[model samples]
Target: MDMEIDLSNLGTVNTMFAALFSKLGVPIKTTISPTVLEEAMNGIVTVRPLPVGTSATGKVDKQCAHFFGVTISEEQAHSGIVVRVTSPAQSKFKLLYFEQEVNGGYGLALQEDSQKTGKVTSAGMYFLHFQVYRMDSTVNALAMAKDPEAAFFKRLEGLQPCEVSALKPGTHIFAVYGDNFFKPASYMIEAMCAKSYEETTERLKEIESKILAKRNDLRQFETEYRKALARFQEVTNRYTQEREAVDDMLRERDNIHCSFTTERTLVNPVGAGCSSSRYTTEHSIPESPENGSLDGRDKSGKKKWFNLNLNRSDKKA
Candidate 1:
């Protein structure tokens, strides 16, 4: 088939796609640059899930696929790159890793152009970042042993303490004995607290930001965590969009008819000749998505990462 695309002037295709999308009422985010897309494509297409065209999940289509992303540029020359990250899910966690490069120098030009046009502000190749903190049983034991106010059996009056291990996900019942104690006392305490797991093991990060003013308290920790959490959520939401792009098949993955504008709308759209329509009109396009936000974000019209302009946030992926 004469379906191969001339990725040399990939920018024109991006402009066209964006123009068409705006007319379709499906707003999307294209952080990856065209240069990245062209470089990644070269002359190859069809990566997975689908065998033809560039199918992906979109803001309008939310199902039928699990990954979708597009790269757009306005430099007339392929000089931009887009990055997307995804979290590990299902039994195929390895397939969903923390980083996936588009390879070559595609991402570099997009960042350089971002410095020039400011269209793509943030540099760094976008990659899925998972903030997973491990909770060690030793830490808990050490904390209890170190704290004078709650150490040993002084609080319990008279009892020798046993070194406790990591917090278990079930109930606990144990006995305590001391050197000069009268006898052993058996205590049964039902520990059904989800906080132990949720707060400690789930999401955690490091401390190195000038915004929180530096501290060693709950408030400080929370402040730092929330800031990073926002960014992480942004990455997750963007990566999830790939599902839509893959489902639409020929028309949705149109390399020749893709574009973005100053107003955040797509242009050109499908039918600039994708040859993908050979399937069926009611081929059931995959569900990409409608609103692309974390909370009230993509929905509430909140400012995106570009608006932040943080010196640190400016750091590339």
Candidate 2:
């Protein structure tokens, strides 16, 4: 059966085609009958074009794609999405349109074939490959190679405006890739079976709101941490000053005690005889004790006493 798939309107064409193919399985010779072909041709699906100036755009790098259909960052070889379309076996899938905005004037190159190195040029001539895999396939493109099929299937890329005739019916993964050295590129992409522009726009807004909220929370935490650190420092400084003052007082007390001990030693000699030899006084010493007591006498029968006489002159040595 003859069918016309117009992709001129890059915005809405992919959506219409996706809806159409979903109802009509892959047009295989064995399964697609003449009646089904006619029905598909007559039944045209129309999708509303995204409102003017409402198209959503996003950034993609070799590492990740943000706010776009699918993203692969430089750190990763590929990015994927699990897509469930109506006619998985017979659908004619296409990536009708995409727009890219770049930063730092860096060009992006997408690998068209897994075995070959995709070329790069100063001009923004980049290509993207899509690979579709069965949903049940345990092989994860993001994971390390477990087997040859998993490895091979994971690296596979498909042409844009992808032709899905060869894909089998069921849930599948759609993976995108770029050249190994592809720089950070910002672009927007839409797929035949992907969400509508409006839906994507809304989803992006929700994601942005969540990110902003998280940022605010982090800022608040940082402010609180700084304040706490300041308080701790103040306490430490005060404690150090108080401790130093106490140390100073103890040192002064020790010095005073030392000085007092030295003065007392000079004033009263420990073993020197306290006779008129050291100190002289005008008052004469009594020859004997009045009560026959020897309270001030030393063991040698000499009196040991300090005589205080203000009128006495200094004695000769």
Candidate 3:
């Protein structure tokens, strides 16, 4: 069996594979003056006037990407370097980090033509983009740009802290720009060698100790939370039982109906026949209630005087 493959469409095939494997890049549509960019390439110092890009029409370009390069010496690269950008109060700028590729495609040209064109048609041979060493992981240039103007004011108000650590021994490129339609003014750029290995080890040990302490605190908090939960459950059960007992008592009371009836009975005294100076008179007796009896009064034939008789026809002395 014979197998053959045609490589005539090699360029097309490579292009398709590149599209499938590679990430889409942000087009370099904005640029600053080559003179200012050149000055910013010097590491470990302050660059002023903020290298803002102006369009061909002389309008400030918000999309401008000011490329700043910091070349790390072989000695500095072993320890790494910390690149920090400090913007003024109430003014802000953002940084996007990129590591230059070994092929070196004339990364972000420092030419007058590129600035006047208002676009960096020249491609940069850098990758690993748009992330800072000390910035919040969630914040990036793209995310800030996507926010609405009103919603993004607070992010622009305060000082935007931008810092990055480059470990490689080469020229590391950083793109500084303004977002949310805000223009960046004067700011400072600084690059310094990272701490020594001994210092870094000490820091790691301190962090480990603090983490252990935090774990102990978390365990204590969990124990207290469990104890509180158990107490809450006990109180809830007791309250329920008490509520049921009171309800039972109320139900029993509701079942018992209480009614009152006032009936008066007329009774004549035993000495009714004797009509002397002391005459017998009629008296009234109240019927006893079903639930209770009258206050221990003598109901027998003992001479008792009562003026509650309804029959007033009988005369008394």
Candidate 4:
């Protein structure tokens, strides 16, 4: 990742070095470039110097300085994702990527800050070294991260994607050298897992609501279909009863005269003007033969059962 790197002195380059070495128990000293100091005070995008002393010291308390107007922006792609690290002020600074090792080793990458100051630029390195790992792991089992010393990058043992659990799960620092000066930088990168179940529950609730609504809609549709089928069956039953009655009346009259059945010829089987309709005259449908008897109503003249009238035959004038 060729991102624009930043190394600010916080205007305490000399004392910071002493504090770092004193903490590390190493008698190491450091130097800063005049240009790097000037750019840092003026809030310009710049790098710090990495002067060296001769002490077998340990790690230093991370100096917290930001690259003026720096940010990491990205774009997801088909193969993977492409990210950019940008700078805001003009001039030159070294940006680095790094990881800490378990065997007390450090990994680093040497790169330059974007030239466009107070603006974004597209010119950065595209490195292929993906992982930084511990010395115990194989090159294939895991990868490691590198130090931000954008000067001379040390090789990483193994590195995992985004998760620092494979290596040391703590803060890692990188030092960037602007030509001659050394500015140590720190990155608060973590490679942990997901947190908080509230978000997952909220998503599940949303899905459940949709499913419930769909189920209710299906039940309502089924109910309507059932009602329509009941009405159709009632009409068919009435039609069959009326036709049978007509056939019985003809047979009864056949004993009186046999020649009339032959002359009628079934009257074309339909269109005899028998009208059918619902009886919605506010009469409740009877539940049973004993529903509206002395058990439901008193000895009053109140209607009890639901009924429909059919005009099948008129007294011929």
Candidate maximizing TM-score? 3
How many residue pairs clash in model 2? 10
lDDT of 2 by residue, 77-96 (tens): 22122222111122122111
Worst 10 residues of 3 by lDDT: 120-129
Task: For candidate 1, write residues 1-317 as lDDT tens digits.
Answer: 11222223346667567546534533222233243344333523222232111223211111011222232223311221212212111010001111133542111121110111122211112111222221111223334556643333222222112122122221111111011011211111111222323343222223222212232344455566668879999988887787666655755445435432132333333455433223323446554334443554564454545466664566864
Among all windows of 10 consecutive residues in model 2, the one with the lowest summed lDDT is: 120-129
Per-candidate total of colliding backbone pairs = 58, 10, 0, 35
Cα lDDT computed for each candidate against the true fold: 0.28, 0.32, 0.40, 0.34
TM-score ranking from best to worst? 3, 2, 4, 1
Candidate 3 total steric clashes? 0
Candidate 3 achieves a global lDDT of: 0.40
Give lDDT: candidate 2, residue 33: 24
Model 3 segments more than 4 A misplaced = 1-61, 90-92, 106-166, 196-317
> Which model, 2 or 4, shows the larger lDDT?
4
Error of 1 at 173 (Å): 33
What overall lDDT, based on C-alpha atoms, would model 1 receive against the true structure? 0.28
Superposed by TM-score, candidate 1 places the C-alpha of residue 85 at a distance from the truth, in angstroms, of 53
